[model samples]
Target: MDNKAIATDVLAAVGGKENVTYVTHCVTRLRFNLKDSGLADRDVIEKIPGVIGVQEAGGQYQVIIGTNVGQVYDEVCRVGGFAHETAVMPDKDSVGKKSILSSMLGTIIGCIMPLIPILIGTGLGKCILMIIQLAGIASSDTSMAFYVFSFVFDAGFTFLPVFTAIAAAKHFGSNQLMAALMGCALLHPNWTSLVSAADPKFIGDMFGIPLYGMSYASSLIPAILIVWVMSKLEGFLNAKLPELVRGMLTPLITLLIMTPLSFLLLAPAMGYLAVALGDALLTIYNAGGGVVIALICFVYPWMVVTGTHSTLAIAGMQLMAQTGYDPFSRTLPLVANMSQGAAALACALRTKNKKFRSTCLSTAFTVFFAGVSEPVIYGVTLRLKRPMWAVMIGSAAGGLVAGIFALKAYTWMTPSVINVAMWIGGDGLNNLFVAIAAMVVSAIVSFIATLLIGFEDPTSDEVEEGADYQL
Candidate 1:
């Protein structure tokens, strides 16, 4: 479809300006919150030239338009007259069951995305807190100011379930409130404390089916899937039950069916599967540390192009939480992020396209300083083949070095230059310095390579390639 036609069709499908609640973009998807998902014409929109796929995740209908997603995102906002930010609750019924890879990515993005803004805010808050505590303005041992800082910083991680439910419900196409309610089951004060206790293995059963053994804290997969199923069950009951009883019956039926099935069957199996998979991945990562890094370096940027990098990150986090350090642990992601930033900076300097240059510059700065990389890869690096190759080579080289050094990160934060704090877990500043050094080297190398080889701007034909935000 032509740009104008594509824009017009998308605007119509999302139900004119009045229906649009919010609009946002990720690596390769235009995420929209509409008054109604029913108003969207998914089939037609998916056929758009730039469209790669259509999905409803995180309570938003995402139009995947690949690498040029930002451009199309702008187009979508322009045509639809969406404000820069809008609070739109996702429809719970939007999430679709996914493959192992999809689930892994979904989980990773699920955990991190909801926590990102909080992390940023908390990071800044922690910085301030540390400064104050060190300066004697606040006592770390016993002070209200310290307590306040602790809450703000710990809130995201502590009540992660609430955030995950909101995001996962959006992904699973379920009701956010319903999903959140389900999440509350796992997060409830008594339940959480009990679950955290390492009770002996017991084959608990609901309806005579043996339940799998597991804990729920720092978990993402089970609760997410459970809520999705619950939403489906609720929908089914709503349709089957009589009008008078539907209100009570729908929820009652949903809970009755879902709670047992989930706890007794699905949740246990999924938890085991996640643990096993996470463990197996770590084994492989540890086996050929450098080689694994090389492969990630090679594929990570492309994954970003396809909007699938989150799978790797999610897998890493799940494994990390279980094992205390994921096999794919260390400075690999940091290198990748830095490489993209470097490539973006290179593009910003070399390219003359005002829009492209500006986007690249902004992305480079944010990814480098703030640790958000989607903007760099989707908005800049992946658009240029030579620059992308530079990023890949730099990433691999950096990954290899990081792997050899056996770098590790303790905290879960976005991979960025400032995220160096994450590596300060065990020993002093050794790992942190290694991470910084590797990222710097990778960025410099990628920058040099990009300047040497050069790249092409997206042609007019290529513009339509991202018409649906598939990148």
Candidate 2:
């Protein structure tokens, strides 16, 4: 069926348009924030053509759409009259029912998911520049091409607060412009200059209250916190203040109140928390190194299943931002992604059933190239059972090597074969070598393990369209 048809059917199965409070998509799923999840028939939704599966997590009824999620999401917006590229005010009742963890995941995913394209592009651009400079095409790292790419890529990190604030506002159902203003407020030139000063510790006082100083450029947590406050404060002022002054005064008052509050409290608190987190990760790495990474990789696929890996991914990015080095976040996930694909490749090569082989081949490609493993996880490994074990073993084995080298990544890179270059020059030539070796070990181990474990190959009658992953 076509995207529109699939979207239309799935929307109806999920209690129609009225049941949906808000909708968004990540790389492979249509994440629906519903007024009542029970209103939707998961079975019916799963049976719909083009839907790969259904999952309820993080306060969302997620329809797995594989590679074509974007097109289907657009169709969903068009058919449901939902605004394109904007989040609606979420259902209050549904929001209240979410666990604290779920809400946090939703907010983080909402905020960070939008920025992924920029991060990926920046990493890839840097990778290409490295290739060019290495080939002697750009003379040296100080060449004009290097400077151009530096600025182009640097803009994302430098202005991250502004971007994050806008995204947080959208997630919080606040004013985007107001959120943007808050982001800008964090990175204001005056603040940047003060932060760059020699002492750079304190900004004297406001109303005799000691004002502490901290830089907000390339920040994440601070922007999210400030914008969240902006949403609440904006809402309160909008409700209580007289209508005549509501629009003009609310924004003015929100900025006036939140800006100083951020510097004096929120930003500093967030900065400390960020530092503690990075330090804690570093300490853990120091203690176990490769063993820690192996354990993480072994458990990561389950985290992906439960949709909890997002927390780690976000933490990884924060670690990189805070310390300019991430020991596991960028590296282990890369090994795990390759392991899943490799495991599925084993299944593909082992299976004689034409349809099962095709299924394995396609999901392996999707996970390896597209950087999404939901398909491989559900479509191949879980179905075969043994391949799931192979995935864990393979990724964990690769993770051991990663730990021994203590690979350090400097970007918000995702897990994928294409992104191996993002891991390059992380520490030096040795880091690149470690990345390649880890990936190779992951694939070989997963492939060999799957073959050795020997999962029961699906028979001709057992396989059907969506049979492998669509449960």
Candidate 3:
């Protein structure tokens, strides 16, 4: 879709490359840390071709660009001569202006957003493995073929701490190598063995104090927190340490001090905090029943809109570890995502402009298959205004049905048509059917509602003035 042209327009609209401090993207949005947000034209940027929506949240300027965000991001970087390899942290001045909560949210989003592509690929690989097993093509989990694929796909999650550490290190402006080494220490075979062993002696005592040994595989909080502290320590040391000794000694001192603090203090404390939060969410889910589930589904798209949905990954991971499945992941695709796709499809059918129709169709395809809804939500529904109500209505209806049926996902995969097979073994074939039913209900409802409510057609002038229409 002329990605280079779109990138040029985006760069210009945001007040040229000089106005940008940093630029990065998630599944569907180009997140920009602007030097002066006031200088950029949000409305004009929103109207740009290929741009779906623009939001100022968490001290960042976000431009929604659908699934092609990565391609567009690459072009944006190329046009602006920005480095994609380096992490893009918010400016210190920007952080100072934001509340603690906003700053924390921004930090979490920045650290985790970079990992989405790899996570999606691995999740899909795991789904493929499940499909093979379910089809009886590979009957045994112990088969050599299974083992090979399993390790290849599972390694990402198994060593997730390392990736998180790298991202966190970049976000916090720390030594990446040292941060990665600390992550490795958390998942070291020797330490993991000690924790998994039957005898308490394997963990042994440290200065008459029993060591708390917990496997850090697939963990999020500890890796992020540890690296943050490491970054601060390294920054302090870099300023104080002699220039001649800084290179080698800084990493050495940081690792020596941070490692013990991580294992003996930070990891255990963060681990407990994760568990407590997960337990609390589960408790609320149990107590509130179908009403809570419906509400979550209705508000899920809004969460994605504000970048708060990424936080759920932590709770979803912890819940999977504890309960062998996570209902949150399952419910989202059936209701929130399906409804968004449906609304996009409605826009495509109802719109007369050929270009807008094509864009809506492509967005619908991404939402239905990839399970990313931000583009559809921001680009089409939210922009059109009335269609958003249609999506919510459809989502609430579908969520009610899913909650009533008690549909849950067995594996930790993003909810999508590709991962529908994951529902097969955990909740029986009936649950899978119910999930399908939920999707159908959401899509039909949203589509019909959008058609009924209708939206303003893009005028020739508007289309020419700005590429505001979804592409």
Candidate 4:
């Protein structure tokens, strides 16, 4: 019933080392791409000691493991092998494009995933800074002590392009280092100073090509394009070149053809696309902000269920950076996360089974305090149909309220209760408080709703021993 035994069972169920095509873990699940989907014994895997559940969505067989998922994933990879073992699966063509709906959801979750650890770490770091400064234990200007906490907290966002490139590359099937290098090129020192100056001439020429003065630091688009291009180039070279020459030839060709193109054409075009997309989102906001929020609220839970929320996070950040506020789309998901968390907590308390009880408790606490909702999505709401209604009711109420306030968020901050401060100082504080209040009200209201409308009995397997259910 321990993690090791559970991991062993999972390895065996998913066709063992040979069957695994590729493997990775998000906040809550061990997502795998298998050579033969039929090889996986979902029921058997679901009944494993540590696993919370098993489901196939997004073209991947996902093993739910609650909070310590990363640890289990690591073990799976170790016993499995990079290609023959846990890490062996290559990126398959089937993992290609999903519907626009799926893509949008995927982007939102992707955007938030990298940002979560950084946001929580930084927010708490800032909290520490506040405590120390308030208590005369530290000073922003004079204390070397301030720098330590400040750097740890602030470094992630500051170097977000690098972080984004890593995640995006994994998503898009490119060399992570090459993608990171491309991100580095986008964030090159010279580019930063040029963009900051806002000089028309800053958009200079690169070997007869016009340089696009876009900042890549915390920005999106350019790095994604660069990485996408990298994937194509890698694939092209791998396919055409002979195996003997591929070792040296692929990287050379990819870097030569792809890198220059990334700097000259890809980055700039994507920058333009990003700007256009942000503008488009704002246009929608200006026209029907209320309706947009209501819809997002309604479907956001489904997005969460399907691992598609990352798109929104990226789009929201891009929108916020381009225009002061991102129409009505920015804060709806925040409410959704809070609502789901609250509902899950209620379910945790309502359920008699130990597995549901543990999952609900851990997921609810983290989602409430830290604003990470994967636990609730994987462990509770998705399992019990009624709890989802609680999330929906809360999301609809919260989204409508958000739309009415027309709240504006300036920074690309995470949707945590702690992030309320970052949203306060920028632009005017018009509906910032209202947005926060709506999120809180929605959470509480939805939590109570779940209690009133209870769910079916937990499955016998869902009530297993030593589940270690924390999200």
**CA lDDT, every model vs. true structure:** 0.66, 0.81, 0.78, 0.70
The C-alpha local distance difference test score for the whole of candidate 1 amounts to: 0.66
lDDT of 4 by residue, 69-158 (tens): 777766776677552111232545535434665444443344335455664566556655655665677686888778776777666666
Better by TM-score, candidate 2 or 1: 2
Residue 226, candidate 4: Cα error in Å is 1.9
How do all models score by TM-score? Answer: 0.72, 0.94, 0.90, 0.78
lDDT of 3 by residue, 1-471 (tens): 889998999999998998877788887888887767888898788767778778777767888787788999999999999876665555666556656886677677778778776776776777778778867788345589787878887887778889989988877777788889988999999888878884532365666766676777888788999999988898899999999999989988887898778888898788778778878988887787677878887887777777667677657777765566777656865688889999989988888887777667876877788887876666578767888889888888888888877777766666777668766656347878978888888889989998998899776565454344444
In order of listing, the candidates' clash counts read 30, 2, 4, 23
Best by lDDT: 2
Question: Highest TM-score: which candidate?
Answer: 2
Q: Between candidates 3 and 4, name the one with more favorable TM-score.
A: 3
Deviation in Å, model 3, residue 205 alpha carbon:
4.6
Q: What lDDT does model 4 reach? A: 0.70
TM-score for candidate 4: 0.78
- lDDT-superior candidate, 3 or 4: 3
Candidate 2 ranges beyond 4 A from true positions: 139-145, 198-201, 467-471
Indicate the residue-level lDDT of 350 in model 4.
75
Model 2, range 1-471, lDDT digits (tens) per residue?
Answer: 489998899899999999887788887888888888889998888778787778877767788888788899999999999986467776566667778877777777778777877877887777777667667678435587678777898787788888898888877788998789878877888878887783556778877888777777777888898888888898899889999878789878887898789888898788778767878988898899899999999988787776667678777877777777678688767888899999998988888888888888888898888788888887889767878899999999999998988877766667677766677664357887888899899999999999999899888766775663531
